[model samples]
Structures are given as structure tokens and as C-alpha cells.
Target: MTTVELPADAMDPTRDDRKSAKIAAGRVRPEPGAREVGGFGLGREVLRSGQMLQAGVSGDRFSPEDRFCPVFFLDGERHKKARTAIARYFTPKAINTHHRLVMERTTERLLGRLRATGTARLDELSYELAVAVAAEIIGLTGSDQATMAGRIEASLFATRVGSRNKAVRFGVGLVSALHAGRFYLRDVRPAIRARRAERRDDVISHLIDESYPDRAILVECMTYAVAGMVTTREFIVMAAWHLFEDDALRARFVAADAADQTAILEEILRLEPVAAMLHRRAERDVAFTGAVAAAGDVLAINIRAANVDPAAVGACPHALDPDRGTKQKQVGSFLSFGDGSHRCPGAQVAMAESRIFLDGLFAVPGIRLERAPDLTWFDGLGSYELRHAVIACTPAPTAD
Candidate 1:
């Protein structure tokens, strides 16, 4: 490790002191070659690896050849193209039309469960609700939804921290469940064939009728499943938690006269964005914030950092003050859904689904917090899982 000392007087309070301290101490050493970021390596080291301008790399991370590299699972040009094709279905107008019914039914179902129980765990509740609605939209049967969700979570983020024990065992279980879902899909090809023979209004029928290639259709279906299944679930729970933590803000949202939920949703996304970071590997030497990233250099932009940047959002960055009195504050030019050519196509659907879920959730009388949930995130997985949360929604007391 190389270190270079700098003058103590040159401190800038305007910048993040920790970030500045690293650069001042020459702690920003670049590794020899263009390298990957944030995968089994130290997050800081991976971030700094992109600082090397001299390293030679193929810059192929964004190419179709690297599609399975985890980074490209949600990044790169192929994702962009895939998004373009998929956007035909996920357009704002289309999502508004198709997802409204799904959201309503899902909200009612979840609220029904909550109404029966005085208190319930929002973590499992929201995830299951989101997955069910997503599965229905993507043409998966009700019987398949729970199994598919388990599989997707396992395959996507089952990680082992060390050489031993129960976390690893649980991860193995997750992977097994995920693999089972894949195995189930092995018969899906014939299932699709039979479904094509019979008439249906689901996405499977549409894919067949539209004559999309089998693989392309499958990928699209899975993308919708993961995007809607995981992301929306996180949004619902996180947003509810946000409301629970801040009573005034919750009241603001609850008292809103109309159903325009975009502003409220935007603030929640900006404040504690469930997807904390977005990954990209340089296709060419790209300049960002005065740093030159060479080809093949993997960069993880901290959407959370960017969202809370004082430069971007002004002071009191972490505080969830929704009354910023402007649209820009709500969006904050955040990379939450990503930016550039590969922004999330399902954003509208996500917002609408969250609104419907929240509408049902808030309708319960005397909703009270039972326990603050643990929101600690697991790295490597590109989503959030709430460890636990319990809230009580009892009937209000009658007037004397």
C-alpha cells in the first residue's frame, strides 16, 4: 500500500471529508490492469481500480459477449437494446392500462391478510404481493408465482460469506430452490406450445402471436418477473417504512386529495433508494467527475451517494423532507432507476403498483408501528430483503 501525505490546511468541508481524506493520503492507488468493481473484491479497491488510465483492456463489458457477467445483467448496450424492444409493452400508457387491474387486485389481497391480523411482517407480505402481481402480468400461473420468486432470489443473490456454516447452508437452499424453478421451466417450452394451441390473453399468448423468438420472449418474461417481482416489493416495504418513521410525511401522503402518487413515490426513491448502486464498465475511456476511466474498467456509481449529494440535493441530504416544493427535488436527477440509454422501462408500472399497494395499506384504521424493521442490505445481490418488520393496524376508537 502506497501513501502520500498532504497539507492538513487544504481540507474542504464542502466535499465529503472521507472521500477527500483518501485522495489527500494518496490512498487512491489504481491496480495494474483494467479491473472489475465490487464483485468479491473490496468495494473501495474495485472503485479505485477504474482510476488507472495506463491499463489496457478490451472494453468488452458492454458487449453482448459479456451478457452473463453480472455487471451486464443490468448494464451495457445489450440491455439497452433489450429495453428498447421490451418498452413496446412497458410504455407509460401501456403499463397504466395493464397494471391498474393487477395492482388493485394485489392491494386488496394483501390488505385482506393484514385486516385479519392485528400485526404482520411487511417484509414477506410485500414481497409475496409484488411477486404475485408480477407473475400474473408476465403470464405465470398462481401456483408458479411463489416457487418462481424463491428461485429468482436464490439464483440471483445466494452468496457465501466465509468457508463455513448456516448462512452458506441457507444460500445453498436458495440456489437449490432457484435451480428447481429453472428445471420447472424445462417443460415450459411444451407448455407454451400447448398454450399457443389454446387461446389466452396472457403475455405467453402475446409472445407466441407476435412471433418473437423463443429465447427473446423468455428473456423478456424473466426480466419482467425480476424487475417487477423484486424492485416493486422493496419499494412497497421501504416506502411504508418511510411513512412509518415520519408521521408528518405519512400524514401528507395520506391526506392527499387526489391519486397522483408520483411525487410521494419519487421522494421515497430519492431518500432511501432500495437499489443503492448501479454498475457500468467503460466501453471506452470515459471522463466523469474529473476522473478518466479506461476501457474495461468497472465502475459502480453510488446512486445513494448521488441522491444525497449536497451539490445535487442541497443540505440536509439524508433527511426525508418531502416538501422541497419542487419537482426537481423529488426526482433529484437521481440514478435510482439508472440513467442514459438503459433507464428502467418498468418505472411507471412500479410507481402505479406502489400507489395501489399504499392506498390499500393506508386505508387500515389506527395503523401503528410495532417494531422498526432491520433494513441491513446484503451485497452482491441487486435487491433488498427486509430482515423483519411488524406493524399493527387496529380499528380506531369510537367517539364518546
Candidate 2:
């Protein structure tokens, strides 16, 4: 193990400044260690090195069974096979063809309702859109949209059992288990039955065709549903908040075409990525920065810090610049999507959904935040939640 001494500036009062200071210092001595590596350059190197393995392989705190079979937890050959099988559904082309219309329609419906209602909670709308897209992709569209969305949210809430108090943790865990079981039985099991009997052009149908057991399919659905619903929901609100704060960026995003909107979406994701950190475990001895990581050592890649690393993004990395060129000659160099084999497979879907939703959202007249959202951070995996993100929209224009 190795430790790097921090300078006085590293003790800056603000959290963001302190993080930046640490990143600046780490760039000077990029080493593999238990402590977080901050800069995008350093973090990217660590992620792409192939020395680190998915942290979920060690055992997921939220669900221990994830280590065995979930796509998120598997490593090496198993991971490759599972990811490749499901990969086609998430491709840019596939999403555009099979699911893009679903996303667009969902966004239009939600935003249209918001425009009529005059005031709406952005987080709720985001969750609804995310659920609809995820559900449609997985062939779980039998349930009503709101009911399905609620079930997904409940399932996610059941996973947050990170409390210091033993009793509280135990109580939450028990409740979470019940909620998760209900979700599996009510929402997931029915979809599995339907898909198994009559396959469709969706992920569940693919799994059925492959003859995956109900338990395996349930786990996979849980993984995708929670990930798809929570991350995208948070990001949509975060991106909208950023746009609502800046007039120029908002105007540019509103007028940008799909190609440019994709770029803007990438940039927004870089600045306010939903995942604050990417966790990895060392597979063998590896030296990084000033530290030597031995086998089984866990490393937390500080995504927020790294995304703004000047070495990668270049000057004024902290500033939100949509046109910031890709770093190190790599497209989408930001670690918002992790690097290496474990990179998020649903990256394109999330980006496309966000772009489509924003297109519908900002299309309305006089769209503005009714109240600033209260941002809260939870313990498990550094999850960020937005509360009270009320937005006001004027009525849609009438046809001439």
C-alpha cells in the first residue's frame, strides 16, 4: 500500500474544490491503490488496464446472489457471453429502430401532460419515461405504465439497506426482501410466462429462446430494471436542472439536431454523471500512481472528479462546455460510462432516451423550474436523488 501526501489546498472548504485538488495531485503520480484515483486520465488508465475486475464479483452488498449470475457481476468469459447475447438490444441502431419510437412517444405523452397541467415534478416524469423505455425493451409491457414504474421504484428502494444502526439496517433489509419478492412475483414472473409462451423481439423473449430458467430471468430483469430506471431518472432531472440554470446551453440544446444532441448529451453526462464512482477489485499486483494494489484490493474510481480532469478534458474541465472535444483521442472519453469490458451496455439507450425526452420537454413554451430541487445523497453506492424538482410549463401552441 502507498499513500500520497496532500497539499494545503487539498483541504479546501468546498467538497468540489477538495476533490479537484486531490485529482490534480494524483495526476503527478498515477499509481494503483486502494485510495481513489481522481483524474479522468488516471481513472481511464486504471479502468482500461485489465488488471481490475468488476467489484460485484466480490459480492454485492445489496444482493449477494448477484455475484453468481447477474450480468453486472459476472466477469471474463461469462460476462462476455451474457453481455454479447443481450448487447444487440441496446445497440444504437437497434434502439433507434425498435425502441426509439417508444421513447419518443413516452416522452411526448408525459411532457404533453405536463404542458397541460402547468406544473409537474421532473423526477416523476423522468422515472415514468425511464420505466416505459426499459419495460418496453425487456418485453414487460403488459402492466400499466404507472404501475410498472412504481414496482420498479419499489424494487430499487428495497436495495438501499446501508445504515450504520444494526436494527435499522435489518428492518430495511427485511422490508426490501419482501418488496423484491413481490416485484418478482407480480411484475417479473407474469412477463416471463407471457414471453416464454409467445416470444417477441425483446430481451425477455431472447432469454426465453435461450432457455434461461425463471430464476435467472428474474435476476436479469431485476438488474436491468433497477439500473435503467434509477440512473436514467436521476440523470434526466440533473441534465434538465443544468439546462434550466443556463440560458445559452438550454437554447443550444433545444435547437440542436439529433447528432448534435447526442454530443450535448455526452457532455451533460460528463458533467453530472449519475454514477459518482465505478468500483473495481484488483485481480493481481498492480502499481498505479504512488500506490501498489495487491490482489483483492478494492478501488473506487472517482467518476465525478475524473470527468473534470484537465488532463483529459483540457482547460476549464470544471466548466460545462458541450463542445469539449473527446479526450486522449478517444470518443466519449469521459468515464460516465465505465471503461474496459465492463463498460455499461445500455449507454446508447440511456443517451438516446435523454435526448428524446429533452427534445419534448424543452419544446414547450415558458418551461422553467418552479422550485429548485433538493439534492440528497444516499449511502449505498453514492446514489443521488432529486426531490421536489417542480417544473412549470406553459400550454402547448394551438394549430393555426
Candidate 3:
């Protein structure tokens, strides 16, 4: 194994400098004269580089001539084309118009379940909500939502690319392929057929319109599913945990207007970014600010570090100040949703969904946090998830 020495604050992975769920926050601040580096300024530059390639199996597993990689990893003209086409659905107006109903309906269903049961795990509800909203936008609504979610997770768990269990991943390779087959057959093909017969204002329909083959479409459907559902669930739970523990913030969130409520959530996201690290491999030599990466070197941009960078967010970067975005020049969600061509297109969709769900959630009279969520880290995704966040309220009276 190789190691590089630097100041402890600059590279400690165990620093609990922030009490953010299970993982100790990362601080990759480069030491003076050290080639290894991280900061919002340099990180942003790295993301924007044309020489960068997505740095994981997901990117390198397939070639464009055979099958397209996930759109998030696409670069140059193809990437631009995909982003431009998908932009129609992610725009604020599109989310409010095409997706708001799905968001509201899903949130209402989860809250109704909690009201009836008197308690539920926050993560489960959030996962369901995330799945439904994302499925609707991606046009995976033809099959069972929960079943699709299970298939996606199961398929990923069977593959080395998405599985945390390194030992069993290849052993389960056949299982992963089978699960993927079932997913395509059960979830994807139906959507493709429906979209082909009559297009809808969704991603799959757009792909069909663009003549993407079935395998390519399935690749995209599954990619969007994981990106939208898995990560958003973690963010919702993490945000709720923070607000539930702080009465002032919860009250502020509930009382604030939509824009302000979103502002508050953005601050929470800034402090507890779900995806801690984003990797990129240098296609050629790259130089940014304080460092240089040679051709073929893989780089990891520490999102947590960049989000809390002193230069980007100003003094007290770690503090949860809702007004910090305006106080400084940082983006609303910080770098949590990422930046440049690879930036998350669903930022508004996530923010809008979170606000709608949380507003209804906090409004539950007598709602209480029964058990604090324990944190679990997903090594494959390089993210932390809150689990077993038990929330309860008085059950809706049994019908006579």
C-alpha cells in the first residue's frame, strides 16, 4: 500500500469535526508544497476539465461503441446532448407541473401510513417517496415501485460496481445479471413499449424518441433509478434527523415560505452532503490551482471538504447557517449535488420533493421522534445513510 504524509487536519478520515451521521467527515486539505490537493476552487476546476474521465467501473465497464455509459459519466458532445434533452423535465416549471402531483401523492401516502400505524421508519417512508417520484420522472411506473426498488438494490449488490461486499460480488455475478434481466423485462420493457406506442413527457420517452436501443435504455433507467432514489432517501432522512433534533430549525422550516424552507434544507444538505467523494480520472495531464495530476492518475474530489472549504463558504463554514449561501458566493446546495457538466440535473426535483414531504411530515400533530436513526455507510456508493429513524404520532382513530 502507498501512503502520503500531510498535516492531520488535511487528510484525516476519522475526524469527527462534524457530528454527521456515522462516518467521520473527510478533510483533504492539501499541505503546502504537497501535490495532493483539495478545495472548492481546485475541485471545481477538476470537475470542469475536459481531460477528466469518470473514475469507476460504471464508467469504464462499457464503451460508447458497444453501449453508452450512464449519462452522468458522458463527456463532450454526447454528454452535452443528453443533458440538453433531459433538461426539459428537470426545469423548475416541469417539476412543478409534471412531477409535483407525484411528489405530493407519494408524501401523502407515507404520512397516511404513519397516521394509521402510529409509527414508521423514516428511511423506509423516504425511500418509498423517492422511488415513486423518480420512477414517475424516469417512466419506470409500469411495474411495482417497491419491486423495482428491490431489483435495483439486489442487482447492484450482486455487482462489484455497486456492491459493498467485495468477497461475494463476483460470486454473485450471475445473480446480478439475472436480477438485471428481471428488471429490464419487468420494469424497463413495459415502459419502453408504452413510450413507443405513445410518448410521455419523461426520460424514457425522450430516449425512445432519440432511438436508443433497449439495452441502452435499460442502462439509463437503472442509472437514473439509483441516482435519484438511493441518494435522495439518504438526504431526506439526514435532513429530517437534523431538523427533528433542533426545535428552532424545525420551527423555522415549518413557518418559512417555500423559498426559505428550501434555503434551510440547502443548509442542512451543505453540512451533511450524502455523497462524500466524487472520483475522476485524468485522461491526460491536468493542472489546477495548487496541484497537477499526470495522465492516467485517478482523482477523488472530497465533497465534504469542498462544501466546508473556508475559502468558499467563508468563516464558520461548518456551521449550519441557512443564510450562508447568500452570505457568501456558494451555490445553494453547495457541491453536494456536484458541479459542471456532470452536475446533478435533478437538484430542483430533489429540493422540491424534500420540501413537500417534510412540510407534511412536520405538520403531523403530536409527531415525535421515537428512536434516533443509526447511521450506516454504503461503501459502494461512498455515502452514508440514516436507518431505523423511528417516527410516531397518535394513530388515526379506528373507523367505527
Candidate 4:
């Protein structure tokens, strides 16, 4: 180990590096005549930008200053109020209720198409399935769902890290897409308006009828709809592809009974966390593991790194071994959903929906990863799109 000595003035803590450290930890570093000590950097800019809205929530919580929407939307007394208002819609109970319908409908409809045609891009198909399920749950029409999905896809690529120079163009594209989506939303506004008039039994109708939630708050929930639909869709495809590509894993997965599903899901989440990193900004000074961070410093938690940390998981951290251990043993260490107060509110719903769809997939005979297409992974985008995934299903085996 190398020993380093600090300058005599270092204790003053007015230096820039110390300021950066303080900002990185979400705390205020001492600064003379400075409103804030932190300097702006790529991390801070990206973290504070509107981009995190598309990033999805984590399984764990960040500092209060680091929380992002809709988690970040509230503070103190109001936080409880907002959470209470939305809790019923997102809770495990509510999600479980929606599972059978969404799962069955999606699988039957999609698999029917897949079987009819022998092969297709499973990734795109999965995305469509998730969009349909989410739209239906949130009371959007088929066309509305398609439009939303298209726009979100474009927006995601547009906001991707390396594309900053094209941001304006991306912004215009996303805006145009969202405008089209708004037009679609507006087309149904009359229905929402009518529901407000007649009190129809629908989720959007409920939102419309409720006098408590403001229009902005209601619109913000649209992000939730988009997030739930898209992230889970990508996650499903990615997870399935991982299993299908590895024969041993798929066999292990198929052999596991219903009771084993939970463990399998956790292992999948652990091995392939959807969002590899989370971005946040410090609203105040904070400290973490000896790092002092100041206000306005951008903070990023390496989810992929943390999940695979040898010390955290113990033994063969790199492999995807669902049966490696029991489910109870891996809870917090698994950063799949995220951490802390800003953890994913839709995780249970996403997981249930994913498992159900996967079950249907495994049930299909001759479902295999056919046509090894060129594959590339993008960490920034948090997904991998296959050049092709040619799959064909055989007729179910005749009863012996």
C-alpha cells in the first residue's frame, strides 16, 4: 500500500478536490463566498437532466437529495400523501390482480402470431406485449399504446449518453412523437372527460374523477405507464435470451417448479440487472464509505458492479446460477430493482408479469434460441437487441 500525505491547507477543506468529494457524497463542502461548492461535470449534468425520468427506479434507496421522481416529487409531509394516493394502484396486491389477464392475453395473442408464422424477432414482439398490457392496465387503446411505445423507444435512444450533440434533434423527434401521443391521449380525453361525466369503471376514469390529484400529477403518472411497459418488456426479452442461449440454465429454469420461481427470478435479477447504473444529484452535503460529497455533485451507483461484487454475493459472482442459493439469502445484495426510498415501486408488478410470460414461453414446445444472430450489448441503453432471433415452435407432443 502507498501512503500519501495531505498538505497543511488540506484541513481547511476549501480546496476543489475536497469540494468535488463533498458534492459527490451529497453534502455541502466548505467554500468561502460560494453558494455551492461542487463543480458541474458530465455526471452532474446527466444526473440532473430530464433523462433520469426514463432510467427507471432501483431496488434500493438513495439519499433524500438523490431521490428521483416520482419518488423525488415529494418531501416531508407531502411525500406520504402522494405515495398513499398511488400505493393502491402499484402495490403487489393490485399487480397480482392484473397478472392473469395481462399475462394470458399477451402470451396467447403473441404466441398465436409466433406459431402462425414459425419465427419472428422475439425482442420486438416482447416489447409490443408489454406495451399492450401496460396500456390496457392504464386504460389506453391499442393505437395509443403503439404510439406511446414508438415515441418512448425513440426518446430512449435520443437521450442516450453519447448522443448529446444530436440532443436537439432528438428532443424534436421525441417532442413530435409525444405530440402525436398527446393527440392520441386527447382523442380519448373525451372518453376520460365522459368518464368524469359518467364515472366509468376504469383506471384513467378513476384518475379523472378524483378531485385530489392535480393535472400535472396525473400526467406525471404517464411516465409510470411508460416505464412499466418498456423496462419490463426489455428485461423480459433480455432475461429470456440469456436463458435460451445457455442450455443448462434453461433446463434448470424449466425443471424448477412454481415454488422455485421466486428464487429463479431473484437469480435472474442478480445476474442481469436491467439498469446497470443509477444517476442522482446531491441536494446537500453527505458522506459514504469515507467519501465526502458536496451539494449538486452527481452521484452514480454502479448497480452491475455491486450486484456482482464478490464480497457481497460470495462465490462465482459472474455466473448465472439460480440454484446457487436460497432466495431469502440474496435480498438486499441483489440490486435488480434498486435500493433505498427511491427503489422501484413497480418491481413486484414487473416481476410477476415477467414470470408469467416466461412460464408461457417455457410451456411452448420446441421453443429454443435458434439462429445465433450477431449480438451486441449497450450498457448506456441498458439493453441488447439481437440482429435476429429466429424461433420456431413444434406442435405440442401428442400424449404418450
lDDT of 1 by residue, 1-400 (tens): 1122222234233423111122212322222342323221233223333332211122332344533322225434554554564565566666667667777887787777777777788877788777776665566653455666776665554342322578876877676556645824753454477567784556666667657666555555655666777777767877887677656567777887434356766766776556655555565676654355677665655555566655555555554445422634335325567555545666767777787777678878877668867654444333455657888888444457
How well does candidate 2 score on lDDT at residue 368?
84
Per-residue lDDT of 330-371 in model 2, one digit per residue for the tens? Answer: 455388888888888888899889889998888888888888
Over 4 Å off in model 3, which ranges? 1-17, 25-36, 65-67, 159-169
Query: Looking at model 2, how many pairs of residues clash?
Result: 6
1-400 per-residue lDDT for model 3 (tens digits):
1123334235443422244633544433222222333588888888888888766635667675443566776777888887898998899899877799999988999999999999999999999999999998999888988888888878776433544577766667777789999999999999999999989888999888878899989888888888899989988998888788777778788999998999989988988887777777788898877788898887777788888887897666666677778878667778888888888899899999999999999999789898989886766676776889999998899989
Question: Which ranges in model 2 have alpha carbons more than 4 Å from their true place?
Answer: 1-34, 56-68, 164-167, 287-291, 326-328, 396-400
- List model 4 lDDT by residue over 240-284, tens digit each: 766676565566668877546656666767766655555554556
The parts of candidate 4 lying over 4 Å away from their true place are: 1-76, 142-148, 154-157, 160-191, 198-203, 209-222, 324-328, 372-387, 395-400
RMSD in angstroms between candidate 2 and the native structure over all alpha carbons: 7.2
| Clash count (model 3, backbone only) | 0
Q: What is the alpha-carbon lDDT for the whole of candidate 2?
A: 0.74
Model 4 weakest lDDT span, ten residues long: 15-24
Per-model TM-score versus the true fold: 0.71, 0.85, 0.89, 0.70
Q: After superposition, how far is residue 11 of candidate 2 from its true place, in Å?
A: 25
Higher-lDDT candidate among 1 and 3? 3
Candidate 1 vs. true structure, TM-score:
0.71
Q: List the residue pairs that clash in candidate 3.
A: none
TM-score of 2: 0.85
Give me the displacement of residue 170 in model 3, in angstroms: 3.2
Of the two candidates 2 and 4, the one with more favorable TM-score, higher being better, is: 2
